[model samples]
Target: MKIQKSFAQSVGTLYLVPTPIGNLEDMTFRAVKTLQTVDLIASEDTRNTQKLLNHFEVKVPQKSLHEHNYNERIPELLDFLRDGKSIAQVSDAGMPSISDPGHELVVACIEADIPVVALPGATAGMTALIASGLLPQPFYFYGFLQRKKSSQKKELEDLRNQTATLIFYESPHRVKETLKNVAEVFGNREVVICRELTKLYEEYLRGTAEELIEYLSEHSLKGECCLLVSGATEIAEEEVFEGTLKEQVEALISEGQTSKEAIKSVAKRHNLKKQDVYKEYHEL
Candidate 1:
């Protein structure tokens, strides 16, 4: 385990800065200052990041670091950091490594004993989650699903038994199709589609998967979308409980539920007090 003191001053650091997802005002003061002070800014798209820099009047020079060039660029960035030159990494929008470039660079930096400081600003997944009208906490942030229908459905099926809220990012053109898969695999569960977040025309579409699929059938959606799906219900959880109370709880635990969650599910299924279920599951 390596401990990183971000501001050690002896060695150069890599700052993971966040940019606004849609509205430019979401950029944080610290993020701008870090960008301005860094020796270099490694951006997923130099052209896209340039507009943000121009707006904030940050004069820092930028280098391209997208998926295509990351393999070749990581070495150069390591060299820059080793030379005691701090750098800031940013994506087109939102946090640097959330469904964007920078994760690999971060790993490289860690392995090389370089300090990496991340500044929180904006993230489309969390932004959409809080307003999704779904359970906010205990959420699973699945960035993007496979483009193919079979693979997407298979992936959804694997997550069907999960009890946490699921978040996904999708292009507008594929939103309707993705919803159709959700409806078929997960049934008519409650789903929310957040579009154009933080922009003037931002919109949220809330309904059952089937309902939104039908709405999009007649309408066209613009802007990138965040799709939130409610997770497995109590009814679905009960379906897997087929044996004794202790055995049932163990089964849920084996399926990745925590001991507390397994006890709660067992209690809910049998209409027993949580204490009673917990006692039985613990063999106390």
Candidate 2:
């Protein structure tokens, strides 16, 4: 195991600065200070970040490090850090690397034994979670669902038995469809939609998925959305197995699941390792 001491570092540090999701006042003093102090600011969008820097009167040199260019940009950024030129990475809104670009760079820095410091600030998931009025602790942060209907439904099915609250970020155009998928997989559980957080027109809609879908049928939603779904009811696992592991896997495969999917389902249902289930199924 490796230990990281953020402040005590010989090389230039990488500060993950969090920006405001909506209200400009949400920008912390430390965040502003770090941006000003850093030698270079690696931003998800240079143009978008420039506006924020302009607002805060922070005039640090900016470079684009978004999803499209991160693979190529990480090396140069690491070189800067090696040269003792500090960097503060910022996304367009909220925290960098939450649902944005920065995680890869963080991983790269860690692999290279570089210090990565994260400054606490605004995040849409937690910001919506605290006010969601649902079970707060042990909640799952699942940012963004699969856009394809079948794949998205499959993803929801994988989390069908989770007892922790599920949080997801969805675009305005797709929130309704995602809610429908949640209802189909997790049933008509309580769901909350937080919209335009920290802004003047912020709004929250709380109800079961079906109820929310009925409401959305009439109104057109605007702005980014955070979807919070209540967890499944706590239930004891089945005390007995229906058949041998091999038989169970075969049953699922016969019913149309791929071998990999069947093996995964068997493993999760029996609380066994996937490799163990695969071996039993293959008699290896």
Candidate 3:
């Protein structure tokens, strides 16, 4: 009998490798092995990935794969796959497909019948959510919000009635604005704000949306911020308005507004005291 190998038994290889969210311990053993053995690794930046590869002692050749050059880079990465060589994709942090450019290459791999495996590792949103101490029942991952004020407000409006919890990734500078906008569209709903996760001085603050806005307004934030907003309170189908404090507050908080701004909006809408809204929101 002759030894036989079918074409199906041979195939191209692609890998979605996740990097550390913060502490290096978050890296997985499988991720290490795959990066160690892959023919070439496509990283978001050669310098950033080089630091990671240096730390882990992974010496695979890595080139940049980011938004600027994605149009040109995908075909280059795919060529290795077409040649039956394996390639591992990694981001500066977290899973490659998420909020990162590796998804395009992964999609190409899928279209070409390449074997693409995602080795699970760090993801900031899930990490923040798990550590947030807030209810995790059902949540929406909003990713990064739009920078424009009106657009950001619209984003929140779109999720106004979603019963799932809302999660978002925000920059240090933009956290205040995003919270303000969220407060307008979603109203004084509970919010958990996390920042500089897994690093020294990592912070997690939980409070109503207005309270969060007040807090951030006073403090000069210096690191990345992740906002987790509690979902809309259930509304009776017969009821014209969701009409809860959270909903009321959410409706008023806009992108560039402050707690004071949100409070004014709520007070005007409900014919209630600004003091009363502030007191309930802050217990002050």
Off by over 4 Å in 2: 234-284
Predicted model with the maximum lDDT: 2
Candidate 3, residues 119-182, lDDT tens digits: the string is 7778989889988877787878878888999878877777888888778988988888888888
Off by over 4 Å in 1: 235-284
Better of 1 and 3 by lDDT: 1
Q: Give the winner by TM-score: 2 or 3.
A: 2
Give the CA lDDT, 0 to 100, for residue 276 in model 2. 100
- For each candidate, what TM-score against the reference? 0.82, 0.84, 0.79
Best by TM-score: 2
| Candidate 2 clashing pairs, residues 3+ apart or interchain | none
In model 1, the Cα lDDT at residue 235 comes to 36
Ranking by lDDT: 2, 1, 3
- Relative to the true structure, how large is the alpha-carbon lDDT of every model? 0.92, 0.93, 0.81
Evaluate model 2: give its lDDT.
Answer: 0.93
Candidate 1 lDDT tens digits, 130-198: 998999989999999999998998898778888899999999999999999988888999999999999
